[model samples]
Target: MNLRRILAGGTATIFATTALVACSSSDSEDGEGPIRIGTTDASKSAWTVFEEQAEARDIDLEVVNFGDYSTPNQALSQDELDVNLFQHLKFLAEYNVGSDDDLTPVGASEIVPLALFWKDKDSLDGIEGESIALPNDPSNQGRAINVLVQAGLITLKTPGLITPTPADIDEEASKVSIIPVDAAQTTVAYGEGTPAIINNSFLDRAGIDPNTAVFEDDPESEEAEPYINVFVTKAEDAEDPRVAELVELWHSEEVQNAVATDSAGTSVPVERNAAELQEILDRLEEAERNA
Candidate 1:
């Protein structure tokens, strides 16, 4: 609001304010300049297609790659990036809460489902007494548990929760020994012929064929809503015309084809409005506040 100081000044004060406002505006509007998008190597192939598709439409959308998961949100919040296509709702909520920033989603992007990889067993039924490795991160660990619970391999004492640890397992009713491993270690563990849970992003690095997944979760479910990847901008840009345009481009047939074909069906595109994403963020923020 205080873009300029007007001490009962003339029209010159008004011009300064106008310039500041324009400077702060998102690059997404009118395709005037390149809109930088932050993402990781996991979605590198799909984003390449998105970038190409965006350029042909007269929009200069650029994808900026980062090696670590923690860098993109920081870059976006600092205005070093225009928007980000890297994080899901729960992770974003956690980042927003932890950083005390107001970053919000402008559009829902995709839901990369978690898969269970088995070495010796063909199905969950034959995996009795096997020590199955799971991602140790909070959000992923919970999702890994849910996949096993749904597959009847394991049961949680607290069912339907977003994050359940190894302690939450109900030993009496479970069929497999669920073990926690470093999220990056899941692929290595699974590659050793040990049954394990692997996230879609890490499948390529782990050298695992996604087609060999014994079980996968329904990413469209209400429980999976928090896991949906999104195009996030600052809260102020939520309703920007350019943000809407970029989102529309993503959901268009051209980009959708790129997302599907380039990602090899790993990133499932899900179109959701800002309201739906905000609702989930609000709930998470409230939970954080209470905690």
Candidate 2:
């Protein structure tokens, strides 16, 4: 059972011309073909375990790896892939509303804490009035802003806005100013001696230690619901039992252990049924529409 992997780049332009493939279905009663799933974490050992487990159940699985956050959804939306497991509720909401699509989440994975990496500073102390770089993407940018708020470095005008922008920052009340850069550039900013709020995905590539973060949001907190990574598929396929089985398999001790090891134990496993996950996505979509 060979697991095929497709490596994409950070830019969407590289994926723009990808030829559309036949849409996949979770209901494979005839044992048609492999159920192809897209993800950014294909290199992780957890996926190898997942594939092995799926093969044991006579489930043909193919894992297509993506580099950028944009293409998986695009491929999924275009019916080129069956399902993708790379984003959280907030990111999915943003993509759905912005693209006018209804790609749905079928299972909850885990939430990896976003952290503020300061190569120089030991803590948030004495960082007042300094510039901190963060991901500019809508979903992460808002979360990044909240991390600062949680760190007592900044205050938002709307108090508890989960997806606030830089304009929403109460400049006079905040201790530090935010520099919104491309998501990948956060490390570049940090490398240049500026403090950066980076996503866990970029940590390994940048050789930044996840434990070195001066501050990080609590993954177990209720406020972290929007950040829970999910297995997403087309809305029509949300009720597929095969997909649900695959989701459950992800929580198996073997796969879960591999996931924890891959993320350096920073990834907190979460268990929310499809309905609960959908409710969170709905609320986030509503907020995104309003915003």
Candidate 3:
């Protein structure tokens, strides 16, 4: 895959155009060819579930792996993939604004909570002026700030919201020096020195023990609502019959059990009302536009 085009520009322009072109071209050749799924390279358990579910459905499922958070949504918007299952509504909304992509979420997936890990300290208060690494992606960076605020280590002017940037920090109560790093490198940042707020998948990839972390986002908290990962497709095809079928399959007893067992509580299935889900997505999109 061409990584350069995938990584170019703001989320609205580059990704949206790519998604539009890809989807338009693919739609002409074969609408029912296969269910092409896009996802990040970080989550192993989700990949397993995708494979198992596809096999059971006897449907051809192609998994396109992306190195960064931006590409998957771009590919999905362009119809390069039938669906993508890697990002939360917050990230999706940011991409929509940054790229002007009209993507829509069809299914709710796991919640891989953001966690703050320290190589030197066991408590948040012990770390003063320590360099803290965060995901460079807008959504996760905001999440890291929220995690810090939750730990009482910092204060965000807008708490319990998505895509909050460094500029959003109140500064009065915020002390730690925040460092933005690539999502994949945040785990390594922790090992290099200073504490880092690593996403769940990266932490797992780096073999970091979650118990050693001084703080973690509360999975059940209201702050986590925007971060609930989803399976998304283009807005036009959002309510397609196949899309509903696929979502039902994912929420099935067998699949849910598999996800729960495989992720070991890291990926939980959320029961959300349809209107409520749309409201959350709308709020995120509004936030992204206003940002």
Candidate 3: Cα lDDT at 274: 44
The residue pairs found clashing in candidate 3 are 11-98, 11-99, 12-98, 12-99, 12-100, 13-99, 19-77, 19-78, 23-78
Q: Comparing 1 and 3 by TM-score, which wins?
A: 1
Give a tens-digit lDDT track for model 3, residues 1-291: 111112222345455455435534454235555566666642456456656775777755555556666667766665566777777777777778778777887778767677888886787776877768899886678778888887777777876656578888877777777888999988888888768988766666788876677888887887788988787888777766665666777787777777766655566677664456668889888977776
Top candidate when judged by TM-score against the true structure: 2
TM-scores, all models, native as reference: 0.82, 0.85, 0.74
State the weakest 10-residue window (summed lDDT) of model 3: 1-10
Per-residue CA lDDT of model 2 for 1-291, tens digit only, reads: 545555554455345325224234444323366677888878889998998888877777777777777888988886667778988888898899999999999999888999998887778777888999999987789899999998888998889887889999999999999999999999999999899999988999999889899999988775688999999988887886778888998999989999999998898999998889889888989988887
Give per-candidate clash totals.
0, 0, 9
Tens-digit per-residue lDDT, 141-160, candidate 1:
98898888877888889777
What are the Cα lDDT values of the candidates?
0.74, 0.84, 0.71
CA error at residue 82 for candidate 3, angstroms: 3.1
How far out, in Å, is residue 212 in model 3?
2.6
Please list all clashing residue pairs in model 1, or write none if there are none. Answer: none
> Highest lDDT among the candidates is held by which one?
2
Show where candidate 1 strays beyond 4 Å. Answer: 1-32, 288-291
